[model samples]
Target: MFGELEMVKALLDERKRVVVLTGAGVSAESGVPTFRGQDGLWKSFHTQDLARPDAFESRPELVWEFYNWRRQLVAECEPNPAHHALVELERQIPNFLLITQNVDGLHAKAGSKKLMEMHGSLWQVRCTKCTHAREAREPLPDMPECPVCGHLLRPGVVWFGEPLVAGVLKVAIDQIGRSDVFISIGTSNQVQPAASFYQLAKDHGAVTVEINLEPTPNTGLMDFAVHGKAGEILPELTTGLRESLS
Candidate 1:
């Protein structure tokens, strides 16, 4: 672990282009609940059931209710040390990108300017009728309306069956291709596209690293796999990067 940490620190010290991919595990450290496993049930229905376009089309009110609950819950949680560590990394690296699958908005709250919320955000809403979307942090009505088209509004997240926003995916891939250092943090590497990002980075000759609570399927692909809590590990890494700069 010590050797891996030093290797990653050296990469950061080189000031090369870096890309960091994060998932629910990072937000989990911030007290945010993941919408998977035993904790995914919400009022007898699977959280996944409510997070689909079909469900929203059938019962917009119910979908909004679930989303409202999630928004409120996430709002109560604050960004943890891992989130702040990424912010510091961004400050030090001139070419850096953070692509996150979680929509808790903690990264933005932690002051990450070069961030791509690939799964969208809990604090955003989009029009169902027309192409209109915006960040809406305040508690929304059970069935909010599009101020532009007067149609219903839905949570701006990318549902299970939905494809990721094309533009965001393109940018993320481009960053991965150009990265000199690629780090996967707190992701299970089970989700598509994102799950394969480290491989793409490797193909581009970037050094790949993984930091998770346990081994993921992509662990073998990582040049450095450090298993632990991201909150504990990331701050130490950021401190090392800082000291290296000194």
Candidate 2:
């Protein structure tokens, strides 16, 4: 399925605006656990349930405990070659945007400058009362009180039943709409709005690529569906882009 590297290179060579959307699969290669993976259960509770506002309201400690555990897990991971490759790709492309569904901050650690964490970041905290957000560098308490409002602080991520932040979503959609090439890496394509971006970019005439370990629901719609570890595939693919441009 990856034999069409030449075609992708052609698009890169054209210097078209490119946008990349990544998901948990990209971080999975670096040892971060996926939200719905088999091992995601904690204390007999589904990881998904622990991320909701209702969950936090009912059991804030449980939610914070889950996120704290996840934060530590993410801290243990380092950005792999795929993350580095995307950083280099950003450097090489003048019109580029790196958007991710991941809450992990690995992409930023890899030096991607023009990035949007559409799902928010694990290294941030939002006030439950005032909604003011601030960077969180250290592990927080189970009931970290927001200094700004004295209310509880919540994980700075879009939870189940919550809408994606308007500004972040707008930027992602704008870039996808204007991009000439859109690549989705390691996403399951089951999440909406984000999942719909591939089709949006395709409809707007972008050449789309799906790079994942396996084909997903959106694979059939891609101009290229290359199944493999993104850690391996992305570096090789970007290497081709670099060599072709050089």
Candidate 3:
């Protein structure tokens, strides 16, 4: 409960390139489950077992069932205050990039333009057989076969054991490396690469800020750790940015 508004504002005013790396905590504010934590994983399935390419390949229908549940969850939750606040921060700051680990698409829904979806999005579909390029769309009920290669349609998310899409990862790394400020929101900081970005940004001289409900796993590394719900903290912070930058 430090004042997120003033501190975030100061960081915004001082920094040029801002990189925002978000996690499940932010999406949890919008009502999505922290799916990787204890007592999660598609009806007693382990996250390691369910969220893997091998699992999807072995039992596509089961994978679809799990992701379909996630898709509906994302579909139901609206963007929280934090998401909207980041959208406003993008408007206020110059050269801002949003890099999100959550597959839920709330950041885009909040109108953030320059974004790197590190974990991919649920609202997309790709062919399994030929590996067709992705299309931004909803999942179908019949689970229609791909038009080109007749492979099954699968939800587009970064499955476990999959390297993040190289193109997106490159952009994320570039943004983090070039940033003078890095803001971490609503993430537990346990996941790799996404968790690593804040350190990467800090290593490149970016002032690191963490906005979340508690001290994150990487709290020791952050320059400013604001402990609270992101929904309440971010709008106030965005308002501070407006006050300071003006």
Best by TM-score: 1
- 124-189, model 1: which lDDT tens digit per residue? 899988999999998888889999989999899999899988788888888899999999999999
Q: State each model's C-alpha RMSD to the native.
A: 0.9, 1.1, 1.8
Q: How much is the lDDT of residue 113 in candidate 3? A: 92
| Model 1 worst lDDT window (10 residues) | 7-16
Poorest stretch of ten by lDDT in candidate 2: 1-10
The candidates, ranked best first by TM-score, are 1, 2, 3
What C-alpha root-mean-square deviation, in Å, does candidate 2 show against the real structure?
1.1
Give the residue spans of candidate 1 off by over 4 A.
none
lDDT of 2: 0.89
TM-score of each: 0.98, 0.97, 0.93
lDDT by residue for model 3 over 53-156, one digit each (tens)?
Answer: 88888988887788777777778889988889989988987788888998888899889898888888888788877777565555567465787888787777
Question: Tens digit of lDDT per residue, candidate 2, span 1-246?
Answer: 567666776777785699999998999999988867687688889988888999999999888999998898898899999999999899889999999999999999999999999989999999988968999979788789989779999989999899988787887888899999999999999998898999899889999999999999988889988898999888887898778777
> Candidate 2, after superposition: displacement of residue 194 in Å?
0.8
